[model samples]
Target chain A: MFLQKKFKEYYSRAEIGMPRRFTRREYGFMFFERQMMLRHISFSSSQKLRNFLTEKAPAHVFYSSAYYSKPYEKEMKDKEWLGADLIFDLDADHLALPENCTYERMLGIVKNETKKLLDDFLIRDFGFDDLEVVFSGSRGYHIHIYDREVLELGSRERREIVDYVTGNGVSIELMLGKDNYAVPSVSEPGWYGRIGRAIGSYTDRILSMDDEERKKELKNVKGVGDVRAERIYEGLKRLKKEPRAVNALPKEFIEHLKDRVAIESSRGEADEPVTSDIHRLIRLPTSLHGKTGFLVKPLTLEEFDDFDPLQDAVVFGDEKVSVNVLKPFSIRIKDFSCNAEEGIVEMPEYAAVFACARGFCAEE
Target chain B: MQPTILAKYPFLPEAFDLVKDESMDEILHSPAFNRARELGVARVQRALKNEDSFLFIDERNCFDVVLSFFISKAIVSQMNDSFLLRRHAIFEAKNAYHYLEEESRETADAVARSLGIKRDRNGVSFVTFLKYSPNAYGQWKLANSRLSGGMVEVDDHTFLRLVQEAVRERVEGIKFSVDGLEKTLDLGPIRAELANRKVTHRADRVELESFPPCMKSIMAQIENSINVPHQGRFSLVAFLNGIGMKEEDIMKIMAPIPDFDDRMTRYQVEHITGKEYSTPSCDTMRTYSLCFEPDGLCARIKHPMQYYEYRLHVSSKKV
Candidate 1:
């Protein structure tokens, strides 16, 4: 009753912005009559919307990209809609990082890649200075670009932008200067500049890795021996920390170097389907996570690395509640970390909320 | 506002505005712009800065990327700043000139005449003004543009200079940037219209409602277990697979083919499903005569996947 009251009270006062207005709204129930779980969906008013959230307090909330005139109509065509935001979600699973990486490492890789996406492609190249970057509060990040310019872009144009971000179409020919054979200047625009930076980072990562593995990977770069790998590694390391003339590296070396840089350049990965999907529905920010018992709150790019969702995102306070953990397991929720066999446990306010949210435990 | 006529006389305000205009320069210089197959703004810049450097013609797409963006920007305000005439042909030009009374024939003539392009006696050249052409060239050009061009007969920098010189000769670059041609454009509304408009993506499953004519024909053939040619089968499977159809679904689609070689068909379909090979592209489909009948939208799209995406886009916008 207390948890139910907490949810009802929160919704009664929680006035947050919806991503899109006049959406094809649907609320899914947790464990009630499956037949009536998502029926009579509507976009009537905040009161109606809030009522669904509290009365049923559905397990999931979904809103469409469309802004319909009469969203409750039986036929989809009846709803006269306005516009939708261009949202991109980058998840850890989508990225092809080193295989068998841990969840924490996956999140780390995704965060770095997301940062590069915002800084390099979105801001510097595409000229979107300000963007809505949201921590998915899970294993990925969501980038919502709300500029009018983006909305005008068609599917193909959007795909091309995705292509640029993912380094799919970037070519070495574009980077290498014409006629007078020269190593690519870092000052050149577009993919050339991006590749230069990627090289530095890739080299730093390579140097930090085990030398034996590095040598093997380097050998595969051109079938070069360990001597060449050691030489190339050192040269790349020196090149990373400073800039010199364009022809500083050997032509043969730069030729081989370009291929490696291309691979490194492709590290700017994103889920292509998500970015290109025009009518995608995303998790609503500030809504309590159904799985984590934490709020799906928005975070600034500055706070991206430091923000800890497990601890900082907890909404329920220190009030203790009993929950029956079905299976034997343990979990950490803020200061309350509990290990218990398959039975009931008195979890703190946050732990109980999280356990209940995940369906790992139910309130007793 | 049309800069074609003014392109000839260097001193003409329109000519300077057309070629040397900073907006033109920006678009031309943008990484997206492609003049031809390999010669783009970047490659041209590299060539120009280095006097002895020769521009390499790396063949890719055959259309100008910069022009496509220009057309989209131009239609809202100046309608004839640049010509999108097909085949440099005069009949199409005449047709386009006659269709839109508000559009200027003189402006079209001026651009063609100034560029030394010849016209037939009908006062039309194969080249006429188009927002976006209906031909295959125009379709891929628009879809893949904002890239580089193919090999030009003349030197890269010289041709670029001519195009640039036309825009920059007399117009103040900065002034042209501010008040030249785009004075009337409010992209916000354009964006809103686009957002409200339906769009497509890499669909997980095909929507039968949006199937292009060619695919429909192929499906009809397949449904009856008719013998579709190798090209037809390739096109069919690729189109089906591109839209997220499963291997089993594709096999079912292929079941009606004359030979009904399950193993062979499975191999081909799996090739695409596994991403070992991609679906036949727009050009390949056209080459095999497997291209479906024109449905008006065919002019705007190139590949079957593109058609599927466009269908989803259209449906999404349906209200």
Candidate 2:
């Protein structure tokens, strides 16, 4: 009851950012207690959306990235889709991190993945500029491209984009050549260029390792015995210059290294389904996540480098609140740090809301 | 535009503009169009049979070529068979591609421009490339192809292939208002050609194991009494119907769900099956976000029915 009131109070005061073409997008809301979403709701203006947010105080708010001719239509077909902003969702849940990684570490890793997606794939490769990056408020980040060129892409084309970023169908033979030994210049475009650089870095890493480490790495590569590994190590610099120069070594060894570079050169690992789904409802910017009570905060590309979510996303003020912590938990939000075992505790209102929202604690 | 080129590529918008003034009455009943009608039937028959015989086109018979092309489209439109329409489109596009291969680069570029293929300094627009890249060879995917400066680079052949796809889409969308024209023309031969074109599914047995990964995932959810989404339910019902499953048997499969209202379920099943709603294509499934856990075979086929049939064929062949 306290958290819901606080959320309502926050919504009433907060000047939430409206998505572009506010009237054309469909809005969806999940209330405080309900898991089911009430969607197909359209707002004509910012004030209408603000009024609904203040009145109902939805736990989570979402708006369609797709523009619809009939935004309030009940049936999918009736809602004539005009176009959609291309979205790339980089969530921690999609990453294959260690089982016991800290929350902070997971965020940091996902943040790096998000950067690679934005900088390497979207910006450098795809040449998309009109981008909006938002902290998803719970697990990861969402990068939305509002470039006019990408707006009208169908799901098949979007799927092709997904395949490109995630390196789904990159053929090593094509990258190298028909003979599997045709060394490509590093200036080659796209995956070919990336894999070429990756080979150079792989060789550099192998040469920098101490004798035992270098030997261990080479021996681990299939069909590379101690003798072949020694020869390959001797010509490592040459192999870096010309990937095809290592053919004198075991073919399996060169093939293995090529395979390694192919995997390493894959651009980004954004969630596939999210990118491919043209009518996906992305989290509304500045809305509080139902699970974490943190703001789905939008950031400028410049602010993204220095922004810390735990501090900046914590919107609630620091009033003291009492809550029964169900388990031992340690969290840092804003300037307040809480390290408490299972018991009734007094903490800042923000921490209390965060804990209670995540089901880690309950109001006393 | 040259009339000869227009006749060769009659599906072009310019060709349509020229023919827009011709009356439907002249097209249907004019004894002067007897050669056009004959050639139209031959065009559709060749498409149905997948033959490589060319429509005789020359400077002298350019008018006949243009008229025959429009007459063939009108016949297909009157038939109202999507499958036949698609086959005709592919066949026409393939023919155009073969001709484009022999044509000069300037002519090809002109045709591309006519089809709205935007090209800048980099290459063709990424939108155009992606729009037509589906069902193309593996190397044609953006992941494998050369893309730079926000455009897809293509050589003369690949560019023509893309044009072919554009032409296919244009042909597929060709709907002529021939409601009365169908009564004027004797359409017995064309009707006979369409009788065997409807896809018939093998009804030997329900091979549960042969279900595509998407269907299998939905079946698993249903068997575990997990609530499947509306898209998943529709795809599952359509797929089961496509595989010749009886209404009662499909109902038994849905019985495990907690909220499975028998009457509502049966009604939906009948509506989907009794109406003969074929399985949603793989692309449609992907668009609706129902495609789950696509596997190796998924990449090779375009539809779930094709997946099941291919799997069944392979397994049966091995046995």
Candidate 3:
């Protein structure tokens, strides 16, 4: 009763109207409150949507993928889907970070990767004018592309986009010159461009370094042997000094150089399955996450760098609440860290919300 | 409170001349008002203005006009963020005409039917809008043969103009005859061009020179009674099925096997025929060590199916 009243009161303070869906059947999940099941629901207006949210008080508000012509229709297949947004889910779990890594570290990695995706791939490669980035609230980030040009892309095309973003299926043969002996420049489309740019930068980086550093860097390149490394240094110098450029290297030597570049350059790690899905329900921004008493926040790319989920995403203020804690917990939530023993804890309302939401404590 | 008409909702131009004109007939005829705008709203506006369901005497001209509007207004908002030109592509048309892969097939059909235009399932399709969106947000669009072998991102208005221009270019296709028979095209040049094109087919199996290099090599190996690998056998079966070869003929090709099992071979061939197992992709073939770089015919294409298609396309066989 208290949770419902509190949740409703908090929700009524909305300055802006409820975010409209392409379909009125708003999807949400409140897993810990009950057995979580994803089902379509209709709400006519913002008031009705608010009613559903507060009454159900779902831990998570998920936006459905199906934006139907007849949104009120019950069944998904029966509802004629007009179209949906192209969403890219970037999760912390997808990153190459160490196991048992902290949330902050994982978020940092996600930020770096997502920034690269936005700068290099989305805007530069695909040429999308409008790209939306949002925090997943729990794990990583979500990138939404709203361009009509891609509305009709089927599973095959979506898969190709994933392959491109992840740098998968990039061939070495395609990157190397066949008729003309020049590596495809950075201006080329897709991986050939990426590999070319990587090699150019790598060459510059190695040449700028001392002889020992140069040897170390070349050795680290996956396929470069000592002799090949020496040859590459020689070849790179000739590339810099001579008009013959990189063409002076033998075909076998070029092959090895290309392989080394491919190995060194390949590092696109987006969650593959998410981008390919045409109809995917994503967690709604600004909705409270039941798992951690934190708001599932949405941020622009500019706002993302300064915003920290642990501090900035908390909704509740500093009113204290007493709860019988089940387990000892040490978590940072907006400077009010809950380093409580396995007993009763008289902590702030923010921590209490997290503790109660996580089923870590019972409000007494 | 009255609802506000969202400015630039579809086509960015909020006030078109048709909407501004006080005279009813002038608005109805529309005086070729930015015929490039192809605003689907123009169709509704024209119908409302003309007070008739059909706009032009020739439905292709009308379709071209209406298709522009549907793209400009119905499909995308001029705010530069609506459905990609591929949003709910709904219809696909593929025949001979370059640039157009598909358009709003069902919508066009309904519009055509209403306007007394005959819609052919195949043949005689020109100035098509081919839009294939293959993933969640990745797509290929060819609406109106105006892309000049390249693609461009378009707002509703731009898309409308491009499609209208294409329709105008192929306006001769819009026959004015009573039954469309009198004004129908000769298609003699097109037919001659097709006849002169080199084509490989399952039906034309007797022409050994028309065979793709991979298939030809596989056949040679089969004839020499050399042991073919599992991957080679699979590729052969898939290739045969694709070319519409019969079960007996397919088995005959495989009969030269040193340790041939009749039941096993028959079942595999039957499976390929039934589409129980699809042909492996070029990548999968490479993984199986069955893919070989064959000279000629195979240079540009990746798959055996593509190679066969390429061969048939280049083949100068007559209809």
| RMSD value for candidate 3 | 15.5
Please tell me which predicted candidate would have the highest TM-score against the true structure: 2
For B1-319, candidate 3 gives per-residue lDDT tens digits of: 0001111111212222224334323322455533533344333233223232223324234333433443333222221211122121111111101122233455433333322222353211111222212111112222111112112333333333333333322221222111221122232332333334224333445445665666677778888888776457767887777765656888999988754556546755654454323456666666556666566656666777776666665674553
- Give lDDT tens digits, candidate 2, residues A279-305: 889999999997899999999999888
Provide the clash count, candidate 2. 0
Query: Least accurate stretch of 10 residues (summed lDDT) in model 3 chain A?
Result: A14-23
lDDT of each candidate versus the true structure = 0.52, 0.80, 0.54
Tens digit of lDDT per residue, candidate 1, span B257-296?
6555455457456544432235566676775678767688
Isolated chain B TM-score per model: 0.36, 0.68, 0.35
For every candidate, give the share of true A-B contacts it also has: 0.00, 0.56, 0.00
* Candidate 1 root-mean-square deviation in Å: 17.7
**Model 2, C-alpha of B155: deviation from truth (Å):** 1.7
Regions more than 4 Å wrong, model 2: A34-36, A69-83, A98-100, A149-155, A179-181, A207-211, A227-238, A241-243, A246-255, A318-328, A338-352, A359-364, B53-59, B134-137, B177-319
Q: Give me the displacement of residue A8 in model 3, in angstroms.
A: 3.8
| lDDT ranking of the models | 2, 3, 1
* Residue B63 lDDT, candidate 2, scale 0-100: 77
